[model samples]
Target: MTVSAPIASRADAGGGTPQALLRLDAVGRRFGDTVAVDGVSLEVPAGEFLTLLGPSGCGKTTTLRMIAGFEHPTSGRVLIGGRDVTALPPQKRDVGMVFQNYALFPHLDVWENVAFGLKSRGERGAGVEAAVTRALGLVELEPYARRKVQALSGGQQQRVALARALAPEPPVLLLDEPLSNLDAALRERTRDELRALLKRLGMTAVFVTHDQEEAFALSDRIAVMDRGRLQQVGSPEALYGAPVNAFVASFLGRANFLPATVDSVDGDRAACTVAAGVTWRARLAADSPRGAGARVRLMARPEALTLAAADEPNALRARVLDRRFAGAATFYRMETEAGPELLVQGGPHTASPGDVAGICLVESAQPVAYAAEP
Candidate 1:
């Protein structure tokens, strides 16, 4: 796959006026002397499904809360539909939120639970009933409308919460790991269902999760965070194919980082020589180190590598340290002669543990080279 350059802003790329429905301008949050979030800015256009992805304490949840008017930012502004809502309360923000726990009322039936949000907003009679019915229909939970929340399955309960949030027809929806409580199989099924439902409704949504697969599966764009700061933001393919830094490259998937030095620069490509004295050409971004003799690291995904004859051109000699069957693809762990360990994924091959093989990059593979940190 050809690696494209990281996009700094969607608006900048399109060369048009910003059409952001939800905007966070240098948002920051603090508690006592500890900083929870710092100087983060982002924009989510209308009808876009954006995900805030990171490990725990990375401020993704806090950022979502700020957008929903639950936690106030110490600095910057929050705007929804071109209106500043930084000081507004949750109910006044016109944003729907589905908590991680599904926050359902056990004593209430599905219909009543779905109607609660509208009723709390002083909506009653025919309008509340109609909104409730529409929301339930969207989630396909009308059959369980009369069933108690406690009697419903985990997935059903989650749908009830989603219906309640959507009943009000807010312009933006915030989901906080709503599928984390479901089993593996159910989570996968529900994830597909959720994506379909949201796309059908054209609902502008911001979802939060630490699972990279989940983010990749659902998001139109993903904003990755680390240490309470924004790391990178882009589509799944852009982020995975051309990571801006080492953190993003390592976090998105399994990659083999080979230490190398720049041997030559040719426009957007660089020739780097590894410790084993093997030279490889890798794609380079605009900001990548261009000077010859500059230290850098080549990032290659396991599936991009192939096994070949040791005498083949642009091949590295390596010994297979281990091999494992993984259904469709087998994984081979190898140690290069110069001492760097690498992983290759391919169809079943004759190579096994304790066997010597040639590790070569596939013709279509576009390995990225990042400047090594000091």
Candidate 2:
């Protein structure tokens, strides 16, 4: 069962409008001679959760800062609800921000911290109290309203920070690795709560993370960035199933790339020969190169392969070099005479180290092909 429901907030009330809630047009930022973000462009629809995913120094954080108006772009425009806000200061942007450290005031109690946004905007008395109470309830923190920020646990502090950000009911929410400070187990649990809350409230959010699992779990769509440039933007399933390039295929999940030379193209399928002159069929990307002899790569996930009998057609004999038991599954590092080292995963009864096995790619594998990087 899914956790999403029909969005019924202000964002969707104007049902006929075609404009995106947030738009970035060729945005770029430079610091001295270093390019921090370059030519990044995307559109986020209202009530959708988008995640900026990449490694450190890849400009995910810089992009988020630009959206929040904390950093000005050098070359492009930022549009929120169809208005250009590139020159606006952080305070002027109606964006709620949650940081990695929570950033809650050490001396302020939960209630005061959450009410700060409303109070700054001239709200007071019963109205302010009511808004604070609602925000705390959304994060399940109403019982801890009088607790000091320093006295709460890490997860509790994160909840307080999130409550403070949402108290003002901003149209867009930006989170910069908000769960990074929590332990592994707590981070997992908190992420679940966060996703559910955003969906239930019909909130539009952009989350930044280097963790692939977190991005996959929370985003309706993911925008992958590298070296200050936008790489690919698509739904999580699309990004994982049909990655645009070698970098994306390897980064989003574990993929074994086999070097091959294209022999022929039949519609969207390509026949390629690997190391032993064994021909294999692979699916072609929409922009895949079709020229014969063009160097390309065949990508297959570890779970897509299985063990076959010695005489099975389209199978290769390999020896398991290492085995790791991971409870529900067993991972094997297998070396084949047909060439590259392949990582294969199977049930707990899979091959052990020193065992010889016949490895075969399942017909459902649908391996993707990409031009080999120079």
Model 1 stretches with alpha carbons more than 4 Å out: 1-18, 285-287
Q: Could you tell me the TM-score of candidate 1?
A: 0.92
Show where candidate 2 strays beyond 4 Å.
1-8, 16-18
Candidate 1 C-alpha error for residue 258, in Å: 1.1
**Backbone clash total, candidate 2:** 0
Error of 1 at 118 (Å): 0.9
lDDT of candidate 1 over 1-374, digit per residue (tens): 11132112322346455478899999999998978999999999877899999998999999999999999999999998789999999999988999999888888899999999899899999999988988898888888989999998899899999999988888789999999999999999999999888877767899999999999999999999998899999999999998888888888988899888899998889988875656888997545689999988899999889998777777889998888898988999999986789999966775978888888888899899987867
Residue lDDT tens for model 2, 1-374: 22233432566676765347889999999999999999899999888899999999999999999999999999999998888999999878889999998888888899999998888878899999987998898898999999998899999999999999988888899999999999999999999999999988878899999999999999999999999989899999999988988789899988998888899999889988775546778888765689888888888888888876656676767889998887877888989887889988887766778888888887788888988867
